[model samples]
Target: MPLGTIVRLLGKQSQMGYLDEVYNSVEDLSSDYFQTKACKAMLLKPLNAASSHCHRLKINIDDTKPREVYVCKDTSCYAHCAFSSVPDTLCKCGKVMEYAGDRPENDAKTAAAGSDNGVFVIGSQKFITTDDLQIGNVKIKVLQTRINSAVLYAEVGHDFVDLVFGLLSVPLGCVTKALSQRLSKGCIDNLYRSIAGSAEGCMGPDYKRMLLAPELAPFFGSGASQILEAAESAPKKIKVDSRFSCFKIGGFSNLGRCREQAYRYNSSYGCNRHEFTYCQNTTKTAEICELDPKLHGVQNSNCDAYVKQGPQSFMVTDDLHVRPLTLDSSLRVVSEGKVQMKDLVEKEVALTKLQIMELQRAALMTCEALSSVLLPPKKKKKNLKHLMY
Candidate 1:
């Protein structure tokens, strides 16, 4: 008998029940029966199985040969999407197709390392991995210079009360009181050296006696000793006017002569009195010193006439003026001070916005690629098989 004729006879005689029972019994008797039974037990199990296996039953709509039904296992239906063509067999409803191969996984480890290694480019600015530090050694040196300058200023402002009295023509006690309130410790130390040096020329015996005193002994070393020796070697005093007495009494002939010598000492030895003002108001003292003594003829003509103001003080100016610089002109303004390493790092990090954005973009692209690979494919209906039994 023909296979079709036999199948028809069996279908009609048992109403397809006998064929289904026989198929089920054979499936149960197999070693993989539990898997097969569980699959067949669901109302939608056959549809899922048919879809996954690319099985589809199609009735030939065309007038083709008898027993020529087509069972298509492979079809390409998702050929027009942006990503790639998808196989129809991947979907439950095989009419719907999808790109159903194992997707490429993103290399997250590579991306993170790349982000760390990537050059940060912003507008015309580009910094590489080697230059990623917030505060480098160069900036640290600049900060150190600033701190040293401050400390020097403090020492000069804190000592040498007698020098202030001699220069300002005030009483020694009054000068000491003013220095206590006005000068920083740095400023006073500087003043003591100046007074000691000047005293050696006219008051050499008195200056040496003071240096030997235990209380003032610490200031007599290295740089201070050289200044004292120079003063001690100079010629004795010639009496000048009482107004010019501070310079003459200290054994220098005049305030102008003392200042000239002081300027030479500062320029050669790095003893920068003019550059080391304790406060903004005291900067005027430097300006006054720089004027032509022959022309301006010294008003408060003592070498140390100017008061040293401490760190927190500033000179108040009545006028609000803005001075514009000429092209290529340089302004010689001193820096305010230094910042600590912690503060420096915080500022640098705050300024690295462009770098942070580049890293984030790289991370997002990496994640997007990875997500496409791990996610499962979508479902469709064309892969279903209609079991008439």
Candidate 2:
């Protein structure tokens, strides 16, 4: 009942010469001829309708040359190695040709081909030439998957061929399922176990016993061994007894024995020897003290009393030699000061009361003035007119 089906039926029955006439008639048919059928079906109906006239489908392959092989100049591929000619079925690096036939020598050549430099594969699907490979395409994904799989297996101590085979054996769907599985519970555990075993095999018994314990799970092998070894060899905390030596406080030797002796004797009294001098009479003395040589007296007599010239020769005071104060003196000063502060506060409260009362009165007056200015005016009732019917 559909227009395409009608056209197809007509095309099948009609003679080759009359096919075009039938096709033209179908094209002129109403747009409503078919509903819910595929547009492709309608479009192809004309092709079928005109196909009886000895027409054949022709496909053309564009005249594009294959990309030239760029042999790496690195030692990995042995580009430096001399060869008689480019091998018929293999590259100079032993990689099998793209169109190599299945032969023993070709297979052997390819198996031996790859070096540390690059990979060589036989029968790899040619999605595109190396030059034609674009950023976003299936080719890139496949290449990445292959490279990652190779690296993974290599890390686990598998040879390239074995790694490739192991990866290839895994179905893409299984890979998807593996990816979807929990990494901690499954993939990571297996990976850890494999790496641990590889390390144990390679590193010998001492490492195996110390590093690869099954109980450690994720933290097995060299990582664990390194941590344990580091911890064992780590620097220890050494307790050293540091004693404080007594510092001999004294005056400079150049200032003479009196000054040195004075500093030595009065160090306990917190006096620098050169700062004060003992005088005999009211006259100032220039005679240096026998104990403190730096102190020059105004006169040549010895005095029992000492005078300290205040800093910059300002005020003079008697030395009133006080004994060295004990640590208890510092504590008493703090305690007495606190008690004095409390007594002063108790006496000051009466004086503050009048001032506080005056402040409160000023605050109240300010608040009243502010409220009168900010408050809204009270609304008055509006009188309404009443109409009597």
Candidate 3:
């Protein structure tokens, strides 16, 4: 867990009666006792809620488009809106919701949501998995990679390695929002929800998108791995309303001039009567009017990459420990897992968008990302079907 997450959890628990809880030592505070206490509040939500912690509604987990959910007029219960099927507008908390009829517009990101830029293929690699979630070094056997049985490690080239290493540049808010707060970290989900709810009407859509789904800093993105799927925001430009038009200083008569006879101010700022130009407002002094809106959007970015391209092959363990592929390193991993040659089997795993997302989520929460995401589930295990998106 991040230090910020820990600090926020501690702060919240302190007010909820941390002093009364019994613990053997200060280290015990990090145990499940406190974690359960924190999650206890959200337990009141519906077991199948397809929304976020802030009561924002979504049709499903991968509902990229944010829907306008009904809110309670009274403060009885701020839980998410739930349908009772018998004309009762009940909240997830079982309280009647006073309908606030105004449904705001969807978030700005909705426009670009699900818009694929192009096919992003990471790399090709051969992997082996074992039933007990441990495996050993074996003869180099290449086969079609499979996703369902990768309970061990992956041997990959620099492309896949660069993609994994590129995960550091992703914003935590984007990941949390992408996962819909299934991050299972400190109340980061709640914090993100609180900020989102508080800034709904106060902030612009662009600002809201920035807060919730911030993009990588200019020139710092990996083109090979957009698993997080955060679209780069277009440059925001101020548009001149039709109520006002640009006049050449004292050239009000120029409005009727032909395109060639127009006297307008042109500058080296790349504004050839395109971007911002001298114009008098309706009731104010001379201001600027925008003709074309693409001036400021030209950002000089290189390859949208961070790591240098190379031929280095690496081994990523189930626990996400990345190391160069060498006999010594492979031997150490196999010895640690206590795996044998007989217990291992190879599979072809494709680093697609969805698979990468699962890997990213597992990497954030546990060391056993491979086992947790790729390992087949037991028969009795209950899956989060609503969150499958």
Candidate 4:
């Protein structure tokens, strides 16, 4: 019997005697996921199996292959997509992520290493905390924090905060995990755009202008205006070319990388999760090889290409407002004062040492002069001795 038929039958009657016998007859079928009590409960309200971050399922329209569509769970991804295989990857919220089903036999081992949304546990204790969420050595910035208060906030990139995502006074780790779950469901991009778009036509310059200025147009393209135009004109796709600037490929050197545009380069391995192309042969210069007219280049081939890469990884914007403590301009003043004081002390010590050395040399010269002046009668005694002989 079909699963749909069983569901329909289950809806008519709460309990069925033969259902258990039928389930027993089926091979490799477990009662854990299909308990009678669970089925009745699910009939009232559907269950969301995708809630877990370790495993996700992808369904297809056609039925040509087996029904194993399990993929990597990505709760914080911007597009709400899943990965086929686990690699060095991140969710849209900038959390270092791990997939559970990547290694089924050693699932416990994988959990010990890392978990979805950059969370993990060691022994019985969990590492999730509000003080700071770190991926490797890079500190994941907390946008806002309140001790002994119910309200807490976390920075999920693009200068946006995860407000109202956690309990008022819970440990920071719980808050981070809650925010990570929200981010995985495509909220990061939405919140980012909502906040960014609200700044348009404001009184002063916006965030994009502050980080990427007009002088950087040659390498990046354009700033606020170009992005606004792209958003307003085309909601789905944004074109990349020499006209617009301000797109930065993270972890990739933007020097003589792109064949057509010397400054535009492909992201290094693991830098761009999906290997997206910032430039293509669709541009006029790329079609005819304007940089060097001698060589014939493929219209869409030479710009930036990757081979056998994974699915499109969700991309996040950089946060420019928050800087490290060591680079704070206010702290530089105190450091400079301390440096000046140290230099003065060093110079004073050197001067004192030089004076002591000079005094010792002068004393030696004076002693020699005194000996010569006081011992003038020695030659007369020697002459008397010679006459006596």
**Which candidate has the top score in TM-score?**
3
| Model 3, span 216-269: residue lDDT tens | 432224532366675543322221122112222112233332132434556665
lDDT tens readout by residue for model 1, 1-389 = 11112223344232221222222222333222111121111111111101111111132121211111111123232221111111222122233222222222233543443333221111233323222221101010111122221210111111121111111111112222222332222243344444344334433343233332211111111111121221211111122222222221222122243233322246667775543322222211110011111111112223211122232221110010111222221112112223343332111112122222221121112322111211233345564465443
TM-score of each: 0.12, 0.12, 0.42, 0.12
Q: Which stretches of candidate 3 lie over 4 Å from their true place?
A: 1-150, 202-206, 223-225, 232-302, 379-389
lDDT (CA) for every model shown?
0.21, 0.22, 0.39, 0.22
Q: Any idea what lDDT model 4 has? A: 0.22
Q: Residue by residue across 329-374, what tens digits does model 4's lDDT show?
A: 3234335434332232110011132222221122112322112221
After superposition, which runs of candidate 2 have C-alpha atoms over 4 Å from their true positions? Answer: 1-184, 204-210, 214-389
- Model 1 Cα shift for residue 289 (angstroms): 20
Pick by lDDT: 1 or 4, better one: 4
Displacement of residue 124 (Cα, Å) in model 2 is: 33
| Per-prediction backbone clash count | 27, 14, 8, 17
**Model 4 poorest 10 in a row by lDDT:** 160-169
Name the weakest run of 10 consecutive residues (lDDT summed) in model 3.
41-50
Those runs of model 1 whose alpha carbons end farther than 4 Å from true positions after fitting are 1-210, 213-296, 301-389
